[model samples]
Target: MSGIQYLVCLWILLITQSRFVRSDIQFIEKHEGDSVVFPCAIEQRNPAPFGVYLKRSWLVPNEILFMHTGEDFKMKYDHDKSRTIVSGDPINHTLNVTISELTTKDTDRYYCEFIVENPSSEDEHIPGKTEFFLLVTADTPASVDSGRIETCSGGSVVLPCLPAEEGLAVEGVSLKRQKGQEPVEVLYDSRRHHGNEPPSYSQFPAERFRLTSALGPGGITYNLTLQQLQPEDSALYSCQLLQRDRPDSHASLGRRALFVSVKGDDCSCSSSSTLLYALSSAVVVLLLTIVFVGICLCKLRPSVKPNRQAPIYEDMAGFKDLKSSTKLAPNHLEDTVSVYNNTSVKKSCPENHYESPTGALCPRNETQT
Candidate 1:
């Protein structure tokens, strides 16, 4: 009876020791638009996967982000379905989740819970939980030494303000401009909007200013991006962090003096790619024109030297010349003779001689008798 009681007590002690282990809280920081992996493991060697869940503190009521059964893994959130991936071999008893394209809102404490089928009882399972903290921050972190941002006019610049502490929750942020002696509130956001809508801005033009916050290794850092920058936009700027339920508790997170210089859109301001494209296009056109002209010259060269033939003359019977017996009359005498002959035939009938058909002399009628 004493040995039986001792064996039962030893079995109970072993079960309690196995269930009391807690995972260490891991601190991780990732840049926006990046990816991160959460690691989880069960103390039981080669534990059978019954069910697994991942939850967050900010997501109240239904905080489950992902779940896994012995068959497959599934996600409860709409956005998580696309970006979440469960990667780990079940044989290794590791439950690892990888999430891609991390945003500022992804910064939170994540808890991973695993359920295994109970060995002692049928239709029952035991659960264990572990936690990890993730901080999603921007690629460009704010510097504490100097707060100065430089940009050209008509462009945009992000004024950075990173908190010095780590894992601190951000309640609200306000951006201010200090010019001369007075400070003007450029934008103020309380982070209390619905449907994932961004925070609201104050008196300043809402379109020109945007509020951005990210989780960093230090803490929650807020930033502001000024759009359509102008020379007048250059001034001393500062961003303050507000405590929850304490509107007056405006803590100075960072200060940045913006220097926006006028950017002229002149010929020299053209991008290198545009200039290179223009030059390449011009060169291609010039080469094409030269090739076309060369082809035309090659095609026309054969026609330049024309084929020639010698002239031919043919004689006619009437144009044959015959030798004349009488002396040839001069051009002036021939003209006078032609005029005299033409007068002899006019109006008066000559009694001496009638003109022959060839315009030569002929005998009169009395001589013929």
Candidate 2:
């Protein structure tokens, strides 16, 4: 076969495989910090399938989460060991896997395959395969609208937790501090214990956190007092209350969150410096605008050029006579004559020629010579 024929066959195979994969894919959406369960069913056979494989699909390589062979099961990844569980029932021909505490980073596609022995030959084949696309969205913090408090460093502040219903008896209370993506549990107070165990809160310092109960207008309020506050203490604090009547209910009875801001000693100075910087920027911008306008006006103004042409004498007749006389006696005069100025013309001309009021040289009427 030619190379062209091989290329065409490969392209057709890829398109066919892509369509088959798309048909088998299932999409699931959940919020962050939630749990998800995936169920896989296998074909009923005389002997159960040899093994099962659960993998997280990627562009180049796939991550193997669970691998089962006969009656043995193994979890391949250490990070998911505590959060992932896989169980299979040969009699029911079913496989189930559960993952808890999911984050946005866990959003990806997964593949589940069942391996079986081929009846005709001594080879293993995949009898069934399934694909899942898990989408984990960011979960917004709960109860941020309760209240906010601001305090300076080295001071103490109180965060209030109010009950959701007016008269429900509170069973347990927990406080968590949300800084970045994760919430750190600061305190947990369990009034009564049920079948399930409460969440642990051993990571934070016990001396710095205190949970106290107080009677207010509301039935009861739980206040979390944080002592010796530092700048790092500024964060969103969430309070959760579990009521005694709802032991089976997994949801909290009420959730309240408060924002706290711990300022440093130089906070005021920093704010003043920022204000001064803004004012300086405004002044600079105003000055630049004024200079630009002045430049534009100067360019647009009309230029007044000096009058280079000689000034015109008021008396044209006398000027004409003077010019004619000068032309007639050009060879007699050694010095250049000034016709416009009366004093200059008098020095060169006869005494009978006097200046008129209009500054024109005129000769008085001469008697009979």
Candidate 3:
């Protein structure tokens, strides 16, 4: 029995030493028409993140105005069922956000938290905290600017939600639905508005909306997965914060406007690609012009000769002949080194020699013949 108890205790110690930890995230700041990356990571090996939560609220002007999670949509007046959704890839562990037509009331501090189940704990799980900040502002539409655009119908956009404070640790992010609709019936979802282009414009896009707390790095996130994009999904979207007891007033978190610009069939297709196309064309034209000029010069060049002597090729035999001719010069020809004697002493041609005043032998047979 004692040995059995010791084994159990040893087993417990081993388990304690190998405890598994949950995931975390890195926060980022992004405005409308811009881009942001919400990080979510796991400390344990292959710990499955089945669910995530994210929440946003008004900060300065009015606190806790409105909010949303992946589920539940509520406003002061009624339930808004078609405006929010979560659009991140759990497998890739990235939380991408986008805010369509922003309004002034969407400015506020955002929060996010992730939960993990601890099998060994009494509660069967532990709620892990996620830290992040959100600053929802009104900016230009990214679909039209240098921004990378994505199309979605219904509720399928990862809106970048900004929290009032940065890095505030929280247990779990809640998705509270809010009600805020346009009484005038905004123009965005309409089949007729689609025009003759491949992309159609439709009015009355989403049927409802909701919000939730994300695992890490929080901000405005998605709630609905749009089946398809329609002309109705073209208008601006507002991410309002939910209050503590009574959600913030629609007037509290000012609205942000995002002008829905489409890739119409006539947004200037003549220019096709970017300015790089023109630059490449210009380079090709310049090279061709240079080649043509070179060809013309080569064909029109005039013939001419260089004012210099050509090279001479000789060997020892040629050198010997030159030397003999120079030495055997005729008597009348002063081709050799001039002998400057003061007295003309006519000496006899003794054999093949001529005696001079200096008593030097001369090649008389070879010269003066």
Candidate that scores best on lDDT: 2
Candidate 1 residue-wise lDDT, 37-111, digit = tens:
887666665457656667764323245554556455667767677898887644345678888998756765677
Each model's lDDT: 0.55, 0.61, 0.37
Q: Pick the candidate with the highest TM-score.
A: 1
TM-score for each predicted model, relative to the true structure: 0.34, 0.31, 0.23
Candidate 1 C-alpha error for residue 179, in Å: 31
lDDT of 2 by residue, 1-369 (tens): 754455456545544543223215566656688998877766687666666767765321365554555454566767677888777743346788888999866665576766666789774544244566665546555423434576777778877765555677877766676554456666666766534555434345777767788776745778778878887777667776666675433322235556566768865555655566566557655666676788789999999998786556646766977876666464336434567665454333342233443223434335412
lDDT of 3 by residue, 1-369 (tens): 554455456545544554233233223334554433334333443454434444453333222212223433233333322333346543333343333333434433344433444567632222334433343343343411211223433224443333323444322121221223221222222122223432222233444332344564444332322234443344344332222333223222223222322223322342343343555556555666676788789899997887875445556557755755565445425333435755454543332323342224645445457
Instruction: Specify the poorest-scoring 10-residue window by lDDT in model 1.
Output: 320-329
For candidate 1, give the lDDT. Answer: 0.55
Cα RMSD for predicted model 3: 25.6
**Candidate 3, which segments miss by more than 4 Å at Cα?**
1-157, 160-233, 239-257, 266-272, 275-310, 314-321, 330-369
List all candidate RMSDs to the true structure. Answer: 30.5, 21.5, 25.6
Candidate order, lDDT descending: 2, 1, 3
